[model samples]
Target: MADIRRRKFVAVLGGMTVAWPLVTRAQQPVKKIGFLSVSSPGAHAPFVAAFNEGLKEVGFLEGQNLAVEYAWAEGNFDRLATLAAGLIHNRVDVIAAMSGDVSIRAAIKASSTIPVVFISGSDPVQTGLVASLARPAMSPASA
Candidate 1:
């Protein structure tokens, strides 16, 4: 059974690999990713580098296919809302809330259509950002 499951998984993965480019080609080119941070740019540079490295591992390169727009609050929580709004105005395809719950909340309140991906220290499900870890709630774009 385990071998059969593995074969099925490999088959699905191979199919997805062949279909991935076609799916992406049907969508908008130059995908935009919004980055929201509570720290200053200087302080978050290493984090940004790590993020870029991760993206590179997935075959994505900045300025070529993926475009990243950064918004830093510089320890000022109040600025996060405005930054989120600016990213929404720019129509970013997805928002990466790099800070804590504050940045995540700001991004959630900013727009419903754009999908928000957050890395938080707190429990996202308990905080009501998601229904569960296994299956996230759909954004307005998906709806």
Candidate 2:
């Protein structure tokens, strides 16, 4: 009887685990957001927290109402290119960049189609990351 009970419990657990993916897939949202920051974790802590909190306030929570992919360059300007390429490969709906002009430029170079939201100290237009902020369209070569 003990063996039989254990077998049934195991069977049920297996079934539930198998079904979980289908159930989750059925409810998953289509939109995905990728956030890239050039600053290190130590530098962007408050900004990251505030960004998450803002989303939470707007009825969106990380991994719940929406999906987010975060990449931090950690103040290394060179990593921005690699990070931007990674985000592009992930095919995120949009990218939010928190670095300086370098990151913004990288994001623009990574993909022209993927919309990028940049919070940078430098001028995005002058850097050619965007044709204009009002109509922010990125081209391939913006260096």
Number of the top candidate by lDDT? Answer: 1
lDDT of each: 0.85, 0.81
| Per-residue lDDT of candidate 2, residues 82-117 (tens digit) | 998999999899988776777777777787788888
What 10-residue stretch in candidate 1 is worst by lDDT?
A: 134-143
Write model 1 residue lDDT over 1-143, tens digit each, in one string: 99999999999999999999888865747889999988899988899999999998997788777999999999999998999999999989999998687788788888867888877677777777777789876333322
Give the poorly placed runs of model 2, Cα more than 4 Å off.
1-30, 139-143
Hey, what RMSD does candidate 1 come out at?
12.4
Pairs in clash, predicted candidate 2 = none
Clashes of 2: 0
What value does the lDDT take at residue 30 in candidate 2? 57
TM for every model, in the order presented, reads 0.73, 0.71
